[model samples]
Target chain A: MIRMSNISWRFLSVWRRNLIVYRKIWKVNFLVPLLEPAFYILAFGLGFQGLVQGLSYGGKALAYTQFMAPALIAISIMYNSFFETTYASFVRMYYQKTFDGMMTTPLSLEEIILAEIVWGATKATAAAAVMTLVLGLFGFVNFPQGLLIVPLAFLGGLAFGAVGMFFTGITPSIDMFNLPIFLFITPMFLFSGTFFPVSGLPEWAQTAALIFPLYHLVELSRACCLGLVETNPLLSLGYLIVFTLCFLVLGLTTMRRRLIK
Target chain B: MDQQPTAAGEIILQVDNLGKHYNGVSAVAGISFAVRAGECFGLLGPNGAGKTSAIRMIYGFAPPSSGSLRVFSLDVADDWRRIRSRVGVCQQDNTLDPDLSVLQNLLIFAGYFQIPADQARERAEELLHFFALEKKREAKVGELSGGLARRLTLARALINDPELIILDEPTTGLDPQSRHLLWEKLHALRARGKTFILTTHYMEEAAQLCDRLVIMDHGRILIEGAPTGLIEAHVGSSIIEVSGADQELVDFLAERKVEFDRMADRLVIYNKGNAEIEQAVRAGFHSRQCTFRSATLEDVFLRLTGRELRE
Candidate 1:
């Protein structure tokens, strides 16, 4: 029932529509990512650096701020993409009737859904780009290697955005979104090596972290930022790709069921 | 896409046994109708009478559970994109993007049809003027009043220069002034030979605009014809009403075999252009708070669909 052929270049129009809207409020949008890294660096650098000791990741001795900077990028990618597709896309689809309007055009449901996911990714990448520059200025991120995080943010964004859209499709109401954020997103945020190393957790907890899509993103961001790898770069990248593809299909299937019915 | 020119009287849309079911309950049950190339065809019904359901299928918003829908001589299931590219739809809901300005809404919508930039801007400006929304072009959609927003929605629908426009309850919540203005705009568009399929609960709106209309109830067409023709066929030319009627009036109507609705406190008698009937009823019931007037499309609608409230 999910027809891939229904998707075409027409989806870009929907993307362009979101971009037009995004550009209008981009200052408020950029403010969060730009200042968020500074907030975390000051908090961790002043508060946690002296208290935390022997912080070694990928065989490299790292300060608390240095260790947490790349992870902040990972979390931003997750938040930007996940929140956009979940809350923003839900508002457009349900409240604003944006998707309903688009469905009337030559744009297919698949194309609209694809455009939403891609737009979510685009926002995530934009935020990540801003955060990378901020973190690089503080000497927390490596020079050329840190630039790779921008594109990596897009991949991570797609993974999170597709899953977020999947939740948007199935969740009954806007308030019900708390269930996914609490049960899925919150746990991943805490456990997926954002502030602490997964290797330090219990053996089973480390294995479980491997299953979270954010874990793969965190690993990739680290590889790109610190040029150090605990997990193989290809393996982490491949995991995110497969996760994105699987959820992309699920997102389309679920959204088609919800919208086209 | 074919480039052949279509004649005015050609059938632009055809539906055969179209049905839609949501979770085992039927919304539209095997209704069939067609729209010619240059007529204002209408679907008139009560709430949940499958008007929106039927309209959704024609514009490819929802797939029919059964049967076929052909738009512009192309099958909807196989060529919906091609059909949709040439068709415009103004949905019942307020689907306008509140984030964008009124003019940006139209320009962005044009991009959906792959309309070029300069041409889209030109057409967008023309539509803004056509809908009388030129002054509010740069205003946020949320700031516009209901009428202004509705006008913008209609303007956005025309951005593609669509051959067929489907308006679902276009004037549902509009005030009389706005409704009249919209009707005038629609009349102008009809004069231009553009085809339209409209769904509405306002009988006057349907009566004034529809060249032909179908009265639907319980997911089925009860009757279909021109407004005056249906009114004449089903209801009559005139009605005599007597409130606080005595049993004498009821017996008199029964004895005369005059078709009438005998309510608890009122007697409504249908007169099919028989002046004698009107005169007789008026003379008999003139002292009983009686009044006589011409029957309208409302009479036909209420007579067919009944006066019961539908949720």
Candidate 2:
């Protein structure tokens, strides 16, 4: 019997515990979302801009780097939330046994997973904001409208965190995580309008990209960051919200089934 | 005997025909027990005998498939959150956060119960010293030795000032000294009216610490009573175990009408007194050690569960 109402304020305790632990290892974790992706931004920004210095390939865009940077920020948020909820949550659940420790102290399994998602989203939210700030410093961002992308990135993070938790909940072994990372996350990173516009891909590839949650996240983040949303941004935001809520329910149930027994 | 707690207004915990199954296979099959307000109760069993399952149910981690389990008179299914704040469970696995310092583990665990920061700090200091890990307070959990980690875990369970402490195989892998120290700490806590519910296969531990315990096997309780009462009722006052014996010893026992169980290569003869074993050992039959001693809980455990390897 998994109920959404089974969650309560105790989720905050788990969230706070992670915060305390994160404080101790902030040098490692904080840098991954902050500095680790800068190399990607620089390498791709400098390397690819030379080819499309004066032209746009997706039929409508200012410059290629300007077109790709917002997607990169969104993708960065997704990866941070994904890895946070997957390997990091796995370590807490299995290796460090912090999950078991928390369970004995009146925290239910549902509350714990909820907290993991919240914490993962928190980390990704920070990464999204920081990267947006970095993009602003580099003059790649478009002022007040660009600032709006930070919150959309946060919403995308919440959705990806839930997705990460779902995979982590069903994983039978540690090595099985590589399957999701390689199969799901890599494809999203490569094709979700991040490195290049999905419009450039084949018709079937674009259709496949629509099914990936990252694609909606990128659409929302890229539009908000560039002030170039053609349609109602709420459509993409609504998709992320629905996706997050669906997985929130599914993640809690799956993790509770796996953990409490 | 006067120090023994009598049945009071209500017991601390109760289980009635409790059962649990994993995918239709029973783990705890229709067993029941009670823990009083101020006494140490034990569940004694071999590995996979369902002691941990029972403990998990009481703590509300593993829900019962059938029957009722209650703690502090509150039903486990309904009032678990209310009951949980008053209870603490020290699980078999070392659930310590390895990335945190020894003191940090207690502090963070205390926060789970919403203990105030100052009070949690004070209790953390007190438990750190009580468990004799005060010196290692700043050391990370990964850096501590096995004994220290176990001690810290026990210390972490105390952070909430819980009334009922449930320990699962508390001394399973501890050295003799560590085991004794843990037993002493438990005794000291018991004296202060902190009720304990413990699970272990160590018969000696049950005899030493538990006021009353149940011996379980194959997912069911075989017997339950006070340590001495169970031994007296099950294994009797004395016993003799003779190995390397011939059929002559069997015939000799038969002539005296001595009831004994013949294992693969030995004879275990039970008695109402030590005289039977003493006289037999003095008679000098060709054998291994002829043991003569007043029975303890181990005798009762072995008699009920048998000496064969459960594995």
Candidate 3:
């Protein structure tokens, strides 16, 4: 059972701590999201546009770049939050002993862990905002409607970050993180319809893709970017919300077990 | 600094029958102690003797398996947040934020206690000066030397201006110069009436800083008293070490009912104001390896904990 008293506004202190560090090398941090989408757009847009012809997505025929542009944003959302909580948080917890230091203060383990998730989501939101602006230059994102993807990024970030943090809690060492990144993350990155539409895959494969959280996030991003969605927006939103809450509780529980022993 | 006043001789920490277990293996086996305000108490023990476990429990870093712990008269289980706000902990590990500048480390830590930005900055500056870290304020923690980083950690712990400070082996790996500097700072703080709970295997540190201490081994308290008192009570005022000891000297001491530790190659005779014993051992035995020295806390620790190697 989660003790509600263990959580408080004090978590912002941890968030602020992360922000100060991020701001130190922010130019380097922002470079990835800003240029990553362009790299993918150039690679796919120029290489595949001629051979692939018009692609059908969300019941609308479109250019190859249009179909993959929103997926790039969704992919960035997943990577930013996932990597932040998994590798970065692991270093701080295991190698740096930052969490152990904070535990001696007024902050509880719940607060520190909660701040990690929130900060991960904040990073995703920031990266998504940068990607959205970069993708807009390519005429892939619609104005005003596309801004909603910022909030969607945060939701997706929570889902991914919470799951990543859960992996961190159970992981014995920093080197062991390669297992989840290889098995769990790589699979999702491929089968989540980030590169191509899921409908093109085998019937069983398409059904399996529905279980991947990244697929739902891609669907929501497409809805915001192109005004078209293959699945109901509410269904995608609800799936992300449920996934985030479940993994968040699991992350906090496992972390408490790992650190509070 | 004295805005939050404290009354001396009042109980600041009360640990009763505290026990901790890992996978059913006990780390702390039901020990109890109390610390009054304005006194430095020491927990002296070797590795795996549960000093860290007990320290963790006192700072509310870990929950005790059994018994009650009250800090500042508040139950740790019920009011850990409140208790933590008033307690400063300098962990055994270097937990400084390496990504931050030396000053940012202190400022950010103060934020954890919900200290106002202005107040935190003021206290941070004061601590930087007090710990002699003002010169490196803008330097990243990664750039600081081990001694400087440790000093920064101690400064960070004081950012909240806590009433009680808990230091776990604060000077384990420092050079003699650094250790002496830290001890000097600790002494200065003690003079200001700050309460501290320190854990260290360095008997000299305990002897110099602790008003009272408990020597622990194998998850049990073997003795508790002031450093000088423990030495006086257990090992007396002096010790005579006779290396290359033989059965003849052992027989001589055994005949007199003199307490001594017979080891594989040497005999340690606990001298309680006995100059004749030293004289006889040197002259009567013709042992060239005999040496006489004042008894210290180390003698008491080795005698109580034994010379057996502990993993």
Model 3: per-residue Cα lDDT at residue A156: 94
Interface RMSD of each: 0.7, 1.0, 0.5
TM agreement with the true structure for every prediction: 0.98, 0.95, 0.98
Residue-level lDDT for A63 in candidate 2: 74
Between prediction 1 and prediction 2, which has the larger lDDT? Answer: 1
lDDT, candidate 2, B70-169, per-residue tens: 8887898787877778888889999998878999899988888888889999999999989989889999888887788888989998887788899999
Q: Which of the two, 1 or 2, has more DockQ? A: 1
The segments of candidate 1 whose C-alpha lies over 4 angstroms from its true place after superposition are B1-5
Q: What is the DockQ of each candidate?
A: 0.91, 0.79, 0.93
Q: What docking grade applies to model 1?
A: high
Which residue runs does candidate 2 get wrong by more than 4 Å?
A53-60, B1-9, B274-277, B284-289
Candidate 2 lDDT tens digits, A1-261: 576556899899889988888887777866765675567668767887777655443355567667877777888888888989999999889887888888788777888898999898888888888888877777778788877876777777789899899988899978899999999999888888776677767989978887888888878776767666533567777878899999887777788878877
Share of true Cα-Cα contacts across chains kept by each model: 0.94, 0.81, 0.98
Q: For model 3, how does the per-residue alpha-carbon lDDT over A43-133 read when each residue is reduced to its tens digit?
A: 9888888888767988889888998999999989999999999999999998899999898888999999999999999999999999999
- Model 1 clashing residue pairs (backbone): none
Candidate 3, residue B68: the lDDT equals 88
